[model samples]
Target chain A: MCGIAGRILNAPGRVGNDLVELMDAQEHRGADSTGFAVYGIPRDSGYILRGMGFNKARLDSDLEEFRLLLKEHGSDFLEDPTFVTSDAAHYCARMVISDPKDLAGWVKDADTISDSFEVQSCGRSLEIVKDTGGAVEVADKHGVRDMIGTHGLGHARLATESSVLPNASHPFWARPFSDVAIVHNGQITNYFTWRDRLHRLGYRFLTENDSELIAVWVSHEMSQGLTMEQALKLSIKQIDGVFTYMIARQDGIGFAKDRYAMKPLVVVWQDGEFAAATEEQAVRRIYPGESEVINYDGPSITEIWGVGNRRAAA
Target chain B: MSEIVIDVGQRPIREINEEIQTACKTAKPIVVRNTLSRHNLGIGLPPGVDITFEGSVGYYCAGLNTGATVTVEKNAGWAVAEGMSDGFVTVGGYAGMSCGAAMIGGLIHVKGNSGPRCGVAMKGGNIVVEGKIGYQSGFMSHAGKIIALGGAGESCADALWQGEVWVAGEIDSLGVDVNVVEPTAEEVAEVDAILDPLGLVDTSRNWRKMISGQRLWYFESRDANAWLMI
Candidate 1:
């Protein structure tokens, strides 16, 4: 079983740190990998891109080729790309870049170098940090606790359907869709079927993780003019599996459960903030006192919690 | 005669349970405080002991109970009294999914609503919910009684086996191979006996007792038409 969590603050505060606490409380669910999707303050100009390079030795050449491809898309690095390196061969990089002429086209070109260096998330406010370890280990490696964001999502994966590669960990950024990400708790049985269909439609999948497919699938539905609420409701019928997933956007976070209600989503909303997790104990870390919690325990349920000035308790 | 207070704040579950087990030897009343909705509290409790959780409890709070009297001041997470042979468990508020799963003997009273599959796969026990029961309340039961005073959610008593699901209010929908029959006076009296201790007996209510239709017991796999009936 995997663990997933989401947090929304009244303002841009320590959402990333709150997410870490949520995941850490549920580390026993899955220690195979830990990941976080932090949504910081939205920027109007440059975009922040986070990614991983397979070999730190090839960092220079891989980035050189990556820079030329960005130039072809009429975008250049606004600042130098910084790397987080260690004894392991793989390293993570964070870069701020000017706007590309065509984001989808540039993403297609970027996937060409995905074998060596892969971009995980690119958005004006979203930054996804993930690695192969428990919550505390990955948090210390990536500095997730200090991140500032209005809302975010977290995941602790057990690697059931695919190999336990670090890149296969979630929350997966919905590629070609900026500032959108998802963290899922169940296996999507028909993901391969939908994956072939989406692949024919020119959507690229970075990993075999089913959560990545759902990320892109929901975003694709929304791109086709479905509102976030409609898309979440449609996923319950369209997707075949026993899953409970939370999809987070720049505005807020939404969730959908499969027909059978195989997974649990316990939520506590108080004082204009929201906290949700696969288990109630995880959310208890946020509200230590006796508080009312809503269990989305029925079948085929979906909800959207908006992050704003007014109270969003539900 | 005094209450033995146990704090369960961020402490380890094993440690807390150990203290509880030791206190049970004293035969004093035990009260758990600052639960914080943690899981696996008060598991495998002994006989004749009295315990109460001051707040909402996480999964398997009074699981595997053996004749101990347990009460939660508020809601309980999944499988509150699973695998218990004998006990009296009371959830002051809601109870999560699979409330009394796999229990052979016990009486679980939920004051508020119950989540999906309230008595799923339960062998023997009596589960009484004062409020409505969620989807598929009595799924695949071997032998037991699930009584709901309020309405029932969709797909109630789906695929039940020998066990009886009695509802007094509106049922959203019946499940596959379920036969809802009018209970005889004796059957209604049996159910009333189960509810009498909880002070929930109502003589003016209409009862719908659900039992298995036995269609799935003898299945012909070669006949694809039989499979389409679901």
Candidate 2:
């Protein structure tokens, strides 16, 4: 079980501030990792920000190495890149890129050269951070308490089948494709079968968690021109067992329940926006009130609006 | 005495429900002043003329109601008329599990989805779910009629005893000892009779009559482990 929060903001210059606060409040959902992706208009990308602990000396050195590596790749790092630290290992970087095509290569290279700390794109131009601790500490350390974005997704993880390192934290980015990530609350029983198929198809995988496989599988399906709804519907037949997954992309977010609806997914739609969670409390923590909540049973589809609709709701 | 009003606005459940019971001594309608009340609200009554919960109740509300006519303006909880000896439990929303469990007599009607085990072991009365039911509904049911308008989950009518299960949607899995049999002439007449009251005879033909496999309930000995035999 993990905590997932985010919004499809109607008004926005940037939505980082709201996204950070939402993710930060749900830290206990996952003590091992905290990750988020912000889908913004005009700029779309992804990042895997890892925690480097309170060792300012080590982090400073790591930062230097990271910067040098960026320079070696012929990409200039952004000035005043954000880096916040907490008692629990936490660090973030704000990078600006002119070329979206180079994202997959850059993320793969970063993962390869970063030693054991893995890196991958969560959709295009999205950013993810997974550290060894809770969400609040990480938010305070990273100054995410005030950061907001237009359309963003966050995950607080409880590691079930992956390493406890930052590399294993969600939202696990689907490789090669930026702007696609997922924070799932149930097991994907067919992960191995799908993983093997993806592997043979030359799609790369960076983690061992079943959650990661879901991102890749969904991304692959989307790449094949299946609408997000179609992909989700097909997946229900392909994957078995109880699950409630919130898959986020640069364009939108989608939630699906298993055929049996064994697990829970609650949503509250108010004032033209919707918030969802595995439990009612998670959504209430962010938008407090006696809002009408929908308790979905069995194979309900909810697609969160993307940044394209930003001006409409505003 | 004036009628008591228990406001169950996210208040502790036991407090509100128990208070209603005590105030029910006046035989007046104890209004639970909330539009949304979750599970097990009005249950296990001794006797009362009339009581109404203002809002929708969660699962198992008004369970085992005896000698009362409970009307809910919204949805009701599971087992709405569970073991009800005599009463009328009406829901504007959905009624859930064991809507009339082992009930002697009563009426329960839901406007939405009901979970599994509906009308389980119901002795008498009619339970209606305008929506669907989950798996293992009416397991070992002794008697009663359960009507479902939506698709059923797996293992429907499992080990059913005497009773009728009417479904309007496709069945996922039929329970053991339970086989689809042609509706008897009496059964068809009964359906027509029931539908006539509700003013719904359009799907009369689509409604399939289901009953327990007599082998399980009529066995003279438990020596064969009758459950598996059924």
lDDT agreement with native, every candidate: 0.91, 0.65
Residue A205 deviation, candidate 1, in Å? 1.5
Put down candidate 1 lDDT per residue, B152-193, tens digits, no spaces: 998899888889999989999887789989899998999999
Tens digits of lDDT, candidate 1, A142-205:
9999998889999999989999988999989888788889999999999999999998987888
Q: After superposition, how far is residue A203 of candidate 1 from its true place, in Å?
A: 1.6
Evaluated at residue B184, the lDDT of candidate 1 is 93
> How high is each candidate's TM-score?
0.97, 0.70
Worst 10 contiguous positions by lDDT, candidate 1 chain B: B221-230
Report the TM-score of candidate 2, chain B only.
0.79
User: What's the lDDT for residue A128 in model 2?
Assistant: 60
Off by over 4 Å in 1: A309-314, B222-230
